[model samples]
Target chain A: MIQAISASDYLQPVHDGAALPPLEAALKNLCRERFRRIDRFIQLALLGSARCVAGRTLQPDCGIYLGSGLGPIGNNILTQQQLIRDAEIPKPVNFVNTLGSSAGFHVARNLGLRGQNFFISRRGASLQAVLGAAMADLTHGVVGQALVGVVEEVTLPLGEHRLRQHLPEDRTLAEGSHWFVLQPGTGDSRSLDLKRFAEFATLEDFLKSVWRTGDRLCCARSMETHAAKTMQRGFDAGALSGPTSAFHDSLEAAWLAAFAVSREPGTLFLVDGHPERGWSLFYLGA
Target chain B: MAGAYIRGVGLSCALGEDAESGVSAMQRRQVRPVVLRLDEFDEPLQMPYYRIPDRAELFDAGRLERLLPPVARAAVAQAGLTPEEIHRLPLFIGSSCFSIGLSESRYAAALAHQSETAIPMPLCGYQDIAAILQRALACRGDTYTYNTACTASANALLGALRMIELGWYRHALVVGAEWANRTTLAGFSGLQIVADALRPFDAARKGIVLGEGIGAVVLSAETDSANRLRVIGGASNCDTWSVTTANTNGKSVAAVLNQALEQTHLRPRQVRGIKAHGTATPAGDTAEALGIRQVFAGLPPLSVLKPYLGHTLGACGINELILFAGALQRSFLPATPGFETPDPALGVQPIITPEAAPDGHYLLNHFGFGGNNTVLVLEKTAP
Candidate 1:
């Protein structure tokens, strides 16, 4: 079993015609040194990861598994505009930061970690992807600790951002950086476990056996509607909802991080996957 | 834990469309890089690029759709998996340019037609490649897309290998793809590292020549009678020295190399040969060479593959792996085509001629941007 020792959830809703609130001051306070040539995506990664690891001494070999839906969107937009629209080559820093792993690099450097660093993406379910990868490494004894983070940046000009994502015109937007520190073995912290079932019936049976009085359930937004509805009906402890007023690509991270930070009394089961493919239940126990 | 076997392989690069033909062309030392001139900028950029021989426009928006599926299909077909196994097969994709070409084309067209409301990135997300492959192959299993620059695909393979070792799945399809896009080309050019030729480990080496390729491998827990190559294990670590390059000191590189060897329970002398990262840049080769020397007292036969297929960045990890594995199956190690003079400062020289690839262990090195370094250990048993 893996344990979730700490978590940081930073979700900021962006008004239609407003600019993103500045993160410089918070980042300066969290980071060890001033980092140059970093874009907003990297800043968000540093912010969330540092905040999660704050007031704690991490193992030097703690691995970093960073996930994102639209990775480094701000830097990518600038680079694409420079190359395609302006007919100019991108600057070196901009080009280098265009990579998703660049953010992981900064996070590793900031925290004095030199362990395994990975940047994995699965669009809407990036949290599951990175968390699964990190848990695997922990289970295999590859690293003693894992720092997993999912960051999504919101660029200016809400209209263009919405168009880029193919969302509705009036759909509210938000930026978020959700982080969790996971470790193997049992401890006083909340225990995290992942269970896979080939069929929905099996998953439901497993959840039924472990359901507590105040335990909550959350069906992934990407889960099939009928299956989600069925799971929702089975659990009476209320469903964990994401920020309804705004959106980011990986809403699952928001839901999971909120629950992790809530200091709640009962277990939270987050179920995902299609009925045909398989079912995955991420259990976070109190 | 048992390692996963390389059951099937497919590749499309500058040499040829199939793995066998690409390896054959490489063994014959066929070095070809077409001159690519981009006149969009004020200073028209010209560089030699090793593109796949598809006869399509380099920047065609639909080129990836046309090029990627066949390569994946070829691997899955070679694996000869059952319909059920194929349906449940997980996908691990690695790439630096995922749907960026399509995004570029759309944004450019929008700019040309309606500049007033044009958006820079019309398509935003890294799931397009996985979605395309899933649709083409009719598989809806889990997907993990990695974007760690050059080490992307190598890390993807490592992830799949560990999961397979843990008995998570019977089989996994790992793909490394990079298609031609203005962002990669123009971005590398702007870094001022685009070289005329890839002369890895040579004293006169300047920088890297960019290339693009699509390579896929089907890894299974059980090996068939014909399977000879098995991905034993690997290690990856970050180099806090610099994000753009590994530390010239080679401590970080050496650390990862030692970590991989220690994890696999192998000593320096047991390694049969080494596939150097060999980007040909001054600092890249220095770091790799110094790292190898730090790990091994007597250097093993080294092979640098970028001469035949230009540095395929993120894809080079798997692309080169397929080519090297194919050569091992044929009982010959590939030669470095561009190594004319060795650098004394680095104390390394790649084999100028093909050598016998004995049945033993080998290490594949992959270093990328963001200070990522990965080393994969492969073993070949007698068929």
Candidate 2:
């Protein structure tokens, strides 16, 4: 019942003043008045979702499921800094954007989606969790269609913290948005299906029980060392982007889900594990 | 499949520590206003906040860790679930600022010391509330955290109910915790939504008085005479008209309310009463009043609980659920506190007098920031 009809993503690498792509024209075309108050994160989310829908007339009950690691952190930190430094009053616009799910609201508002839209914070596996929830809803027929997405904005505060830990210097902290349109598929062979998804309390349990017969294993570099070692030995390891993220992992899974139809029947094993959130394994393909 | 029933509930607020005590104190209308004089604010702002009175050691890093676990334990114990059952229990928690009070302090301390003390990981990113609670309660089932501002815990409950209906889990624990923080205080103060006193659904209503505490519920597929109340159904949606405020036209909220009734197969007349999300903000109350009037032909005896418990924000979903469910179980409808005169323009009136609980159903509405609106319908079964 969890049919993944199509998927798409919008990614960007870190650079000097590499701002979010200009979505104003496209957003304005969708809804001019509501686009005025959207923040960078929301703009990113709308763009990703817009690309996925591709002008397809959607049902009013389309659910918007968005996930973020540091949701609107850039703006949140900036607002907090202004409050601390200048003793300035908190702006209602800035405060609203800081709610983590602001983008979900903006997207729903712009798209005229009246279904359930939620924004959950799951550090490294936010989008996966969001996708999992969407699949549950779709399989149960709670929603006609669900637009699942993840947006993260790498902020200076987060970068400074990462630097302090001396983890990966050129870790390539980036901002990106990835969205997938999940709904019941017609008799289209091009459609990619979500085979299974499981959440484990520990990496050990996840590795021991994750699906094996797959064309490749896709995951973030920093997901888990032991599991990565085992995956490398067992399957064709398809390393996600070096600048690892839940958004990136989801994009990779979507790619694999879409690409699976071009070749012989096979599976794509995706494992995403976080220090605090344990492990999530997703099997996407035929 | 057995319906998901509220086996036990635990809440800590201005009312009391546990649900039974909190419900009792809420019925008695016991309130203590919390005054705020933070470094960010020039004047000492006075607002009605329902903080746990017994724990007056000021906000600190460990406030949530200290306040939440006991409530979780109490709910689990009240449900008569053994430690083994708890260990295998799935948990879903909602929070607007999960451990932000602690994270902010850590960031401040690092600044003071001028030391790169590896910016406490939780501060750099989101705190996994499920992981924190799992460690606290020693439970290991699937966990999720919903963060849709005020409707956070309501979504948590909705998610748990879906999983239970799917036969994925037999029992689930839903928790909501939100403590007052400088950012929220300043943000509301700047928006001019903070009222000097908590006055929900009143003619001269001010804005919300932010409160803090934790609320938890143990939902199980099994039901005994002790806890037979069933979670009938619910619906949640985004207004998308506004981010900070709901649509004054009331179309979006009314749609969601109508959806809840449709899904539950109950008419407005069948609904015994409604727990309005009367935050007392001008736009909020106006929209809610209009929404309720549009959905219910004859407005059920409305009760606003925020005046008694204060607005717990994200925690309001679970906190208010526990409080209202407890009253319904006792067949007692607590009168809407702090409602003296109805605003004529609002066009809806609440039951100012206490009444008996209707044997059919009750609806609870929790509308939140970013136009996130959630409504839950709880059905009362015969004993």
The candidate scoring highest on lDDT is 1
Judged by DockQ, which candidate is best?
A: 1
Pairs of residues at least 3 apart in sequence or in different chains that clash in candidate 1:
none
lDDT by residue (tens digit), candidate 1, B142-209 = 99999999999999999999999988888999999998999999999999999998899999999999
User: Which window of 10 residues has the lowest lDDT sum in candidate 2 chain B?
Assistant: B115-124
- Runs off by more than 4 Å, candidate 1: A239-242
Docking verdict class for candidate 2: acceptable
Candidate 2 residue lDDT tens string, B1-383: 63489988888887888889888886776667666666545654545466677654656667777777889988898889977778778787788877556655666666567644424323544545666788888886656678889999998898888878776668899999887676677777778898877667688998888887789899998888766488877998888777776798888889999989987888888999898888988889988988888887877888888877788888899999998898888887777777788788888877777789968888999988877899998988788
Q: Which RMSD does model 1 reach against the true structure?
A: 1.0
Give candidate 2 regions above 4 Å deviation.
A15-34, A161-166, A189-214, A219-266, A271-281, B42-44, B115-122
Best of the candidates, TM-score: 1
Candidate 2, clashing residue pairs?
none
